[model samples]
Target: MTSRDAKTYEEAVEIVLRTLVKAERIKPTQYARRLVMKEMNPSREARSVSAGLLYSVLQKRGLLDEVIEDVLEITDDVTELDTWVRNAARIAVNEVVFEDGDPDEVADVLHGLVRRLANPGAAAIVKAFTLDLKDYEPPEPEDELDRLKWEYYHPRWLIERWMEMFGDPDEVVALLEANNRRPPLTIRVNTLKVDPEELAERLQRKYRVTVEPGRFLDEILKIPEGLPIGEMPEWEEGLFVIQDEAAALASAVLNPKPGEVVVDLCAAPGGKTTHMAQLMGGEGKIVAIDVDEVRMERLREIAERMGVLDCIETHLMDGREAPEKLGREFADAVLVDPPCSADGTIPKNPERRWRITPDELERLPKFQYELLKAGAEMVKPGGRLLYSTCSMFPEEDEEVVRRFLDEHPEFELLEVKVGDQGFDMPEACRLFPHRHETCGFFIALMGRTG
Candidate 1:
């Protein structure tokens, strides 16, 4: 489709739906990335908004199902609607049911867009769907899973797994809602160039945005609003790096000192790798390893940009076998941030939930446990091993750690102190969105006591 001005919110909704349709046809997870890459003069903020809206809509599938039920009353064969038509209806319903946008206006704009798109068959579908918009009310959520499905916009199976582990259904529901909102924009300042607090003061003066120090990363700046990091002067000079608050905590937990050898297994997109390098004051050896060549390239670029060149090394290899490649007891510290179901990241990528299943959930703990075992082998005696995942599921978090400790007596869990972040995990620290005001994450600090 050609680019057109979205003069009204409806037109904007149409554009978003069309994009999601295109993205779904290609690959669901890569949809937003593909769109952002394709835009010639993309406004990062606008794209972020579109992506957020699309994710929010997809996460609330139960609510969308209700919209479909209402539409079925006006017309049969809703199944015959094309991709764009279905997406348009979803967006309209999302605005009305989820975002609390005006129902009548949403319906009118949805109708207008379908007509303009000239898909007469789809327009008929849109018209039929819009007929009883005034009377449409989403059904109240029934159980804990349903509450999470509506509240956090997560799939039911995910909620079930979390509820089984957390035990408190309400807390799980609250965490899900927090994930659906746009996460705060956080950056880790380069202490090599400036102090984080000092930089925050300078940035606020220039951009008219407030900046605060992040809880864990002393160098992290929490910018409530400002230019995209790429456009900021600090970023161009490698004065700071954009990272999530939970992710920044990984390096702090590792707390690698200068002149030590640190290994990061599954380290791509290099957030923790670079953070570890920074924590070491760029004086230590950091071997950043990942299996994906494409991501390794990204790791290389980030390492270069962050100016941690002398201390950082990139390795493209299967992380499961990384210990064999590096030999046993090779590093002073090891950070294992393995691949996961990414359920905790649903707020960032709503389409991800639809891609996961119970079987997939069952398989993750084994993989994570194996990786942790492999990572443990790479740390020297008395050295630290920090295991982390951006997942709140017990199978991926505490259970895996507990099982690992049971199987391997050589390593012991280290208690983490964050001065009121939350009560410490017996074998790990868990950060939930509702409680920690960060992504739902888990970090286990372990030392090779043997």
Candidate 2:
């Protein structure tokens, strides 16, 4: 019954700065929302402005840090500075240099902010930006990979890795350009509750936002200008759930049928699980397994909201334990969507490009291979097994699948056909942001023939 106080840009900065510092441990968007709820419930306009600023700052963080390092004339990395000072300088440079904000205005706001934070060290960086950041230009690298890294605001090692995989500079550049773009807001219509046509018409009429059919499935819809689904009544009514086209296609690739027993590994936040349930007309059993109890709880909540909970059974355990607990050769279809560096999600989670390291990339395929082996164990003879990931890396995709297939000769790769999208590899479907306008995804469908 009380009116919330208005939130300022400085408060937003405080939230974003703290988020950037903690983003390595947690998701930036989720952490920022938590901070927003705990600190201030701003108006829609204020929230939009803060969200835009945060996304811009995080998206170009690499280039912004470079600008800050240039402005400070320091040979060392800017990360060595105080947290408050470092983040403050990043925001200042991002706004004035990258976003083309008025330097005097940015300086005035940040100076007051630094004073409030009571960090004398931060004031120097803010002052430095006010003076030198106006006309600062980053030096172009002579090397091609280095040029792409600086120009696209990506890590150099990642660029090199992509170049090696793609083998063509133009294709790599296209992928990089695609990753840098803002991702579209796509939602899957919950057919259990309402049909896609009805839901699309309702959304277009009620919200007045542009809605179009998605590329992958008939039930999928795309909103060019994204709506705040959480606050929308249609979302609360569970007419739809937010999901990407490529993610939805993974379930279709598996093609779970009604009355079949399906197992979903690592199925937390249950997007594909629920989609499979819908495909089955909510008549099949989906054993959803995940290690994180909290995320499993969320999956249950989403499944319940989407009116597909009756078909989905949630289990809190590691996906690798699924075969031992559930018995081998039981499931009609098994979906193994294990963890990875998630480089494919860079378009939506720009912070991911910086967070992913070579070590993590090197270690993930073993885990993925193990999970795929477990999934194979659960599939009955002549049943289907689908291994999918939102990763563009060949090591995580083809190499893991190759290892699994070589070890388990009973499972044979099948051609993946989803709405006329052809696979270059002929056995697995790969979706790219530049070509398919979706997240970089790999879906390999296989059948057990023992």
Candidate 3:
């Protein structure tokens, strides 16, 4: 590539990295999208390259930092640099050592990018770091859990917990490997407007991208990655919504009926809420509740874009308050998609593997159980209550459900079979990235028994 072309790609990379460094614990892809739109609109190739690098740096951050520290030690530079320079070094190491890019080409582009930040000395550090990165071996932890965590690019505590849960270290490795890989781009067809086949044809014709029908649901479709599918005309016209297969299956398991009143606790960004609307033929009332104003606004926007806003009543309130505020035992069905560590989403949000802490893991299940109880209180006798989470932890999934069932004699576990993919509980269901090629998820359906 020409020097000008290379410089343009580096600029895109710099813009994305600048934003990414500050967006701690937030979805990096959303920030990347925001920056791409607001800042310089780079070419499609540049966006693709930058996005690949951004995810790579985020995913393998631990290893990259190790390499950078090793190089810094060798160069005898103890001075702490700015977060931007450190991030730049991480991106450079990811490109040169892991992605096997042309080292000299990466060095040249990185120098230009770092120069823009007015850190000429930082550029020297990065250049040396990149050159020596390949030869650096990440220090192996003596403990088995720590070694596995380092090897798999996950938290040591999480690796140990998974070992306890699965009782097999090899199985944990398989799951970790799946989480490290880039997940496919999956979207659900707004069947209330267009069928999957027609939407697939339209997407292919307009975007010139391959669209595969999802394995679990007919209304779901998977598009090739890095297509800027959100910018498509169909998206703006409310033809489909980007959703994962496992998430769609949760709504399917609930199977909301037409004219029924359904409650969607923890419903922000409206993936399951909109799916329920479609299943109900847009004929039912969906009471959606979330605590965050920003996320609730996002839910409204998505519901509007999917043409299901009219069927959804959004409330910016804690789901635990739904029982008192919205009344109890009124809704025909309730979906409790409470928050958790979201370990199952690691494949799509790689930074999550490192972001979740032991304390957070302990706290999430308690909150999840409360959300499930609130949803249960809103379900009428004989009504269905589907509890689900994008978490691989039993503490957040099976254990929470177990405790709820133990405490609430009025609720009985009902069967929730989704083809061959099933949870250990005969009545519940699960989807794993290694097995199901979808986000790791858990679903348990219960009936309010008077």
For model 3, give the RMSD to the true fold.
Answer: 3.2
- Which lDDT tens digits does candidate 1 get at residues 1-450? 223434434434654766666676554444344453455235554555655666667676545755675666535543456776777777777777667776666666677777776577777677666655656766778875676576666667777876776788777767766766665667888887788878888888887888877776677777655345545677778787777788888889889999999999999878888888888889979998899887787777877878887798888898888878878897899999999977766655566666678887688889999889999999999999999888766778778888898999999988876522323355467776677676667888999985
Model 3 misplaced stretches (Cα beyond 4 Å): 1-12, 25-28, 69-81, 100-105, 117-135, 140-151, 419-424
Which regions in candidate 2 have their CA more than 4 angstroms from the true location? Answer: 1-31, 34-39, 69-84, 113-136, 419-424
lDDT of candidate 2? 0.81
| Candidate 3 pairs with clashing backbones | none
Q: Model 3, range 1-450, lDDT digits (tens) per residue?
A: 787777667776776666565574444465555554455656777777666667777788766766777777636332276665777787877787777777777777677767776578877766766666556555759888877777777777778888887798888899989988887789889988898999888878877888888998999898766357555688788888778999999999999999999999999878899999999989979999999898788889988988889999988899998899989999999999998888889888887877788898789988999999989999999899999999888788889999999999899988876733344677888888888889989999999876
Provide the lDDT at 166 for model 3.
Answer: 79
Model 3 Cα displacement at 312 (Å)?
1.4
TM-score of 1: 0.82
Write one digit per residue (lDDT tens) for candidate 2, span 1-450: 112322356556666666665654555474455554455554555555666677777778877887777777778998677776777788888878777777776676677677676565677667666757778766869798778887788999998988888798899899989988877678999988898999888888987888999886899999877776556788877888888898899998889999999999989989998999999999979999999887788789888888889999888988888888878999999999999888888888887788789998889999999999988898999999999998888888888888888888888889886532323457788888888899889999999996
Candidates 1 and 3: which is better by TM-score?
A: 3
Provide the clashing-pair count of each candidate structure: 0, 0, 0
